[model samples]
Target: MAKPTPLNLLADLAQNDTEAATRELGRLQGLRTQAEQQLAALNKYREEYRARMQAMAQDGMTATRWQDYAQFLTSLDGAIRQQGQALAQAEAALLTGRANWQSQKRRQNSFDTLVARAEAREQAAGARREQRANDEYAARLARAASHRQD
Candidate 1:
């Protein structure tokens, strides 16, 4: 990738600090995906349960079968709650990873700014040195001409 911005120079160093954080974020995202998949499966199970319950009711099932249906509904409710908790945890992990990445970026930016400033200062100093040498050379040239005249 072409680095169009001045900040691109800091990419490598910043990546080192953020590497673990980035992995963590990816992990979090994967967990979220898994949770969603499980949630989908649970939804399918709920539909199946409803269908079975309906079939039992139509077939004039005994009171015991109705009790079993109630128990199944309660279990499904608990599973849904658990899936919600998992989603919350995954979201929290993603947030943590984002915070870490931002911190790393800030540190890298500070270092890049310092380096640029130091390079600017060095260039200024070199220019001053060159100017002084040129002044001294001019004075020497003037003296040589004056001596020749004498």
Candidate 2:
């Protein structure tokens, strides 16, 4: 049995790191989607509120009612902005995770290439040793036949 190379161990570690990075990227994407959904819902609700306010104005709303509606709309806008920021952050994190995964994959591939080269070298060496033994055996057989004839 051939002894294991350090490259094999390094490759295993790199594979684990790559898998972890992939999971992290997936989680970030999920968070970004949730943030987007919240932003969409907030905008939809704000539009509905504006429609209701318009209907109220047609019926003649009080000044105090107008002030309250304006304040609530402002708060909704602020929430929407905050959600947008969160989504941006999540997207950035996802990009970073993807980069890390790619780096890990590259490292793993390098180690794997090294391992393959080492195995090929070992196989070649074994083949040479086998050929040498066959040649030595043939030489011995020829000498034995020459001695028998003499």
Candidate 3:
């Protein structure tokens, strides 16, 4: 048998598993990053809005205008709270995804190690067989020379 080793199971199965997990991890990272950026943008806008309101209040704002600003700030707070929850969920999902990828990678590495060891053993055995054949040929030549001398 020329290609005797059936050592591609890891590439077929374990590698696929690891690759899928890696992709999942990447998606989760993107989601988490997006959530964080959105939250930061919302917070920054809220800060700027508040500063504007303060300046208007200093210029003697109308009561209706102040009430409108207060209502909008309340809505903004709700949006911020929802965004915070979304970010938390994204963070949790990313953590789980990372763990899954690490586990899959570990399994793939273990299988790769086993395959490497098996190949090494096969190579060593082949070397031993070659050495034996060489030794046998040398012995035969030496015996032939001895017979000739006798």
* Model number with the top TM-score: 3
After superposition on all C-alphas, the RMSD of every candidate to the true structure, in Å, is: 5.3, 2.0, 2.3
What is the lDDT of every predicted structure here? Answer: 0.81, 0.87, 0.92
Off by over 4 Å in 3: 1-4
lDDT of 2 by residue, 1-150 (tens): 547667677777888888888788888888888988988999899999999999998999999999999999999889989988988888888888888888888987887788888889999999999999999999999999999999
TM-scores for every predicted model:
0.70, 0.86, 0.88
- Tens digits of per-residue lDDT for model 3 on 1-150? 225446656545888999999999999999999999999999999999999999999999999999999999999999999999999999999999999999999998988787878878889999999999999999999999999999
In Å, residue 14's CA in model 1 sits off its true spot by 4.9
The 10-residue segment of model 3 with minimum total lDDT is 1-10
Could you give the candidate ranking by lDDT, starting with the highest? 3, 2, 1
In Å, residue 68's CA in model 3 sits off its true spot by 1.5
Give a tens-digit lDDT track for model 1, residues 65-134: 8999989888997998899788788778778878887798788777667666767777898899999999
- Pairs with backbone N, CA or C atoms under 3 Å apart (clashes), candidate 1: none
**For each predicted model, how many residue pairs clash, with residues at least 3 apart or on different chains?**
0, 0, 0
Q: What would you estimate as the lDDT of candidate 2?
A: 0.87
